[model samples]
Target: MENPWLKINHSDYENHMIEVGQSQILNSLKKYCLDKYQPKNFALLGCATGNGLEHVKSNVTNKVYAIDINQEYLNKTQEKFENQIINLELLKRDIQNEELAIKNIDLFFVGLVLEYVDPKKTLNKIIETIGKNGILFIVIQKNKQTTFVSKTKYKSLETLSDISNDVNENEIDSFICLKNMELIKKEEIELTKSKSFITLEYRKKE
Candidate 1:
């Protein structure tokens, strides 16, 4: 079956997220990571249409890898950042099925991506690509009272509900520990009374 993400229109997805007040939150989280870490090399998984990539500065983050499963999203991201961001590399890849060729990323952002893919496989693959002592920022949505797909004017976003799975924070913490990564911090940002985003910061051990 084709991934629902591939079928989602960029505008619809963007509008839906914006309406739900998630895009801005995501942008803020990215900004926080970039400002605090100031990583020379950065990568964003599930980088749809470069939502938070504006935080990337050529002087601070020299290299950027923006990856997404949708080609159209990648095209839009390239159009927006190709001239602005130096060494911006855009890749269209299915993290679940394809082998990631990237390595040595100083900081990696996996925001709301693990829910759509096989969490264990993708997490393992991501760990392999991080440089020693690299930082990893993961954002997982906690939908205790809300549906997996938030209601919006754009119904196209609804297709994602079929593939979206809830990720357990404890499981990831345990898995990363076994993989030689230590948790730097865990923060919970409440989006709504029932919905929140849990941000986990991890660092690869030397």
Candidate 2:
């Protein structure tokens, strides 16, 4: 696997997501995260180009582990937030690999990433990394569509057209509860009139 993600331009990806009302969705996520968890330390899985990063408040979140598999994306994040965040940690790791560690994280945000990894195994690994009383946030598409290319195309992301896979929302929800992760809150963000994504907040059971 070439990791089509590495070919994606972080700026273009963020811009496209913004056009799809991702900013609004991320804003709501941020509000819910801060009001509910108030985590001092957190991790943003697949934190590409720092989209939705504005929601991370300095006073509330002291340390952030901005993780992404692609080095270019991490590089952009470093450049964008180097001066803003006081204690920032950039981790380059693949979520599908067992070597990826998120141990003791107060909050974990997995946005638009489960589609690419083995959901159950990856979730298990991530849960183990979350400390007791920690929170995990996941964003999953309500509607399923694979093998589709973007309306706004970028030279780097052209290769992503070949990607095709299913991330069944129902299956994901089932796995979350099976792992003793309780669903605290769930909301659907209408990205478009017809397309939307559901955000599920799960807290560690013990």
Candidate 3:
């Protein structure tokens, strides 16, 4: 089955996310998560058009793997940051079913991508790929907005409404505890009148 992300154009997705205050969420993510633990090697899962790519300090976090399901999105990310990023790896994949090719990453960043996939499987895949004591920085919509669908019209994106899964915060916490991972940090960011995000930072059990 074709992924919904592959159906949406990067420009359209970016515009919609910005319109719905996704950039603000990214700002907080960079502030608390990216800037604090500047990992030497990291992967940005669901990195559509590579938002928050600027937070990586070349001298500190030089190696970055940008992974997404859509080829067009990865292409645009390459065009945008191929010069600034020293070791940029662009991976096109469906992470739910595929093992991450790169291993021992210091940080794994996922931005609102879990809602589209089976979170447990995706989380397991990520956990296996990250090194012991590696960080998993994640953000998910805390509450249902007017709808999961973009208020603005876009055929490819609007279809996301059908497949969108609700992320249960309590269930997430339970899962982390069940896996014996430590919850290092967490925050809630209110982006817009109708939008908010619950961000979490977890350290894998060594």
Q: How far is candidate 1 from the true structure (C-alpha RMSD, Å)?
A: 0.8
Q: Is candidate 2 or candidate 3 better by TM-score?
A: 3
In candidate 2, position 80 carries an lDDT of 89
Q: Count residue pairs with overlapping backbones in model 1.
A: 0
If the candidates were sorted by their TM-score against the true structure, best first, what order would they fall in?
Answer: 1, 3, 2
Off by over 4 Å in 2: 144-150, 155-158
lDDT of 2 at 161: 52
User: How many backbone clashes does every candidate have?
Assistant: 0, 0, 0
| Ten-residue stretch with the least lDDT total in model 3 | 142-151
Write the residue-wise lDDT of candidate 3 on 126-157 in tens digits.
87778878888888886644676657754568
Query: Which pairs of residues have clashing backbones in candidate 3?
Result: none
| Poorly placed runs, candidate 1 (over 4 Å) | none
What would the TM-score be for candidate 1 when compared with the true structure?
0.98
Against the reference, the lDDT scores of all candidates come to 0.92, 0.77, 0.82
The candidate that wins on lDDT is 1
What is candidate 1's lDDT per residue for 1-206, written digit by digit as tens?
88899999999988999999999999999999999989998999999999989988888988999999999999999999899899999988999999789999889999999989899999999999999889999999999967988888898888889999999999988988899899999999999998999999999999
Candidate 1 accuracy as lDDT: 0.92
Candidates 1 and 2 compared: the better one by lDDT is 1
Which tens-of-lDDT digit does each residue in 1-206 have in candidate 2?
Answer: 77889877777777777665665677567667766787888888888887767667788888888989889989999998888888889999987874555578889888877766777877887888787888999987655352333465455655655653456767788888888788888887766555577888889878
